[model samples]
Target: MRNRLVFSAFSAAAVLAVVWPFLFGGQLAWRDMLVLDYPQMTASNFGGGDLFARNAPQDGFLSIIAVVMPATWVVKALMVASAVGAATGAWWLSNKELLPTLSAIALAVANPFVIERLLQGHWSVVIAAWLLPLIAAAALNGRALLVWLLVFVASLTPTGALVGITVALVCMNKHRLVTLGLGVLYLLPWAIPGIIATFRGGQDMNPLAAAQAFAPRAEEAVGTLGALLGLGGIWNADAVPDSRHLGFALFGLGVFACVLLGIRSVPKRLIVLALVGMGIAIFAWLAPAAMAWALEHIPGAGLFRDSQKLLILALPAYVAAI
Candidate 1:
């Protein structure tokens, strides 16, 4: 019960500290999260005729939910809920030790990654953050069915679904094949259709050229490595929170360095996935040509032009590693 209270307090504080504006000011649409303009369900909400269907599942879910409440309220409420849900997911993964729990929660909700994603209006990514930890706990605890269900729902976002699929592969010891099938099942609704449409239409893009445009950015005074370690290099200057520049990013670097001490606590497969995730983020900067080639050749690889989302795959490992 005490741990529950701690979790609840931190979850609420995490949301209120950064997202009070969304809560008090009501719905504010920015970037990809412009659901306020069309709050109600329509025939078009479920249809993304073009490839990528980037808004799949989330936008459609919003349409159904908005019918229950005003769109403004629904938008703000979901934002608040996703933020709180992130912290709660961290707490769920913790071992009930106060310090470790606090550290895990901070990594989960208050990190620069969550803030940057939120500012960029990528609430679905934030929802994925929440789902990642929940799925991790289920996988770690040997709850196969729960892991499959959570991973299936993570298909709401393509990037999140990618990370979620990785979670099933790296974290589970049993039902690996069956769990992996759930990953494919989730993709069936959106990914397959989008890929087919892209090929059928021959909508070609120069992935090599586009890679530079979507590469991870250097942060203010901290540089690209620091920003990526600090979880702040989000490719859009406007998306980074102001606090990141005010010494918080440097602090995050130090904390992330210290987080490596508990590396043995996490499963080895999870560690490999985390390293691969960070490596992928850096690859765009170090080997843009190779990254672009993969983007050009790999089906749906174009979606990762903003490769930082790949770090979502590492969230579970980071929390456990710490």
Candidate 2:
């Protein structure tokens, strides 16, 4: 009980340290994150026309909560809540020693992946990330309902859903059919509507063009490999920290090496998961022609255009191994 209280205090402090300004200062909005005093849900938010349902349930969800609180506060609350929630999840994953627990908390809530996405205003993805480790733990315990419930929350965005499903498959290989069914059901809100919109009203964001435009990029001279090694290769250069271009960017390579060496009783499937994630993260950049071809030929492939989110698949491995 004492340790739990200590962790809770530490986690809250950690979250407030990073996001206190956004909560108390001027309106906190950036990139895709828009803030309005009152956000209303409309027909378009459901799906159809030139728009994809990427922000489907997210916008609708906020609209519902905004009825009781301001949208700015809603978003701020989300950031703080998700970060602290992630730390709690990390505590469960760690060895439960003080030092290891704190280290896992730091890596889970304050790492480059969280930073880049937070700076990019991807609160939805951040929420999914907080749920990642929890989902895996539930799966290992054979908690089917918990797994599906977590995946449903994560699926508010397509990328979040994909990584959640990938983790689910890795952890719960027993009930493949049931897992797949629940996954499809969770994704139906965005996936089905997205396909319908593409066929009927044309695309607002062209997948082939988006594939080329949003390919993984380098932070500096070390190139995309360096950026991704640090778990911070967001296509939007402005979303990344300026320090990412510095000489220390290669520091993550050390973490990667340590993680590989540290693997012991962790599932071998986690390594495969990490490799598959890296492959997807680099796919568009390394094979532009193939990426373009798939984007053109495959329906609803736009979801993969911003491929970096797939890196979340590797995160569980990193957490468990380290």
C-alpha local distance difference test of each model: 0.75, 0.74
TM-score of each: 0.88, 0.88
TM-score of 2: 0.88
Worst 10-residue stretch by lDDT in candidate 1?
43-52
Root-mean-square deviation of candidate 2:
2.6
Model 2 lDDT tens row, 82-159: 676667667766777776677667777777787888789887887788778777767766777878887877886778
Look at candidate 1 and give me any clashing residue pairs. Answer: none
lDDT of 2 at 107: 72
- Kindly list the per-residue Cα lDDT of model 1 for residues 1-322, writing each as its tens digit: 8877877787777668876777665456777667663465654455455445667666776777766765667666655666665676677777778888888877887677777888898877877776787787777779898777767656777777778888777778889898778788777666755766676674567777788877888886779988888767888888887877776678767767866787777778777877898898988788889888887777777778888877777777777666
Stretches of model 2 off by over 4 angstroms after superposition:
1-6, 25-28, 67-74, 173-178, 204-209
Taking all chains together, the TM-score of candidate 1 against the true structure is 0.88
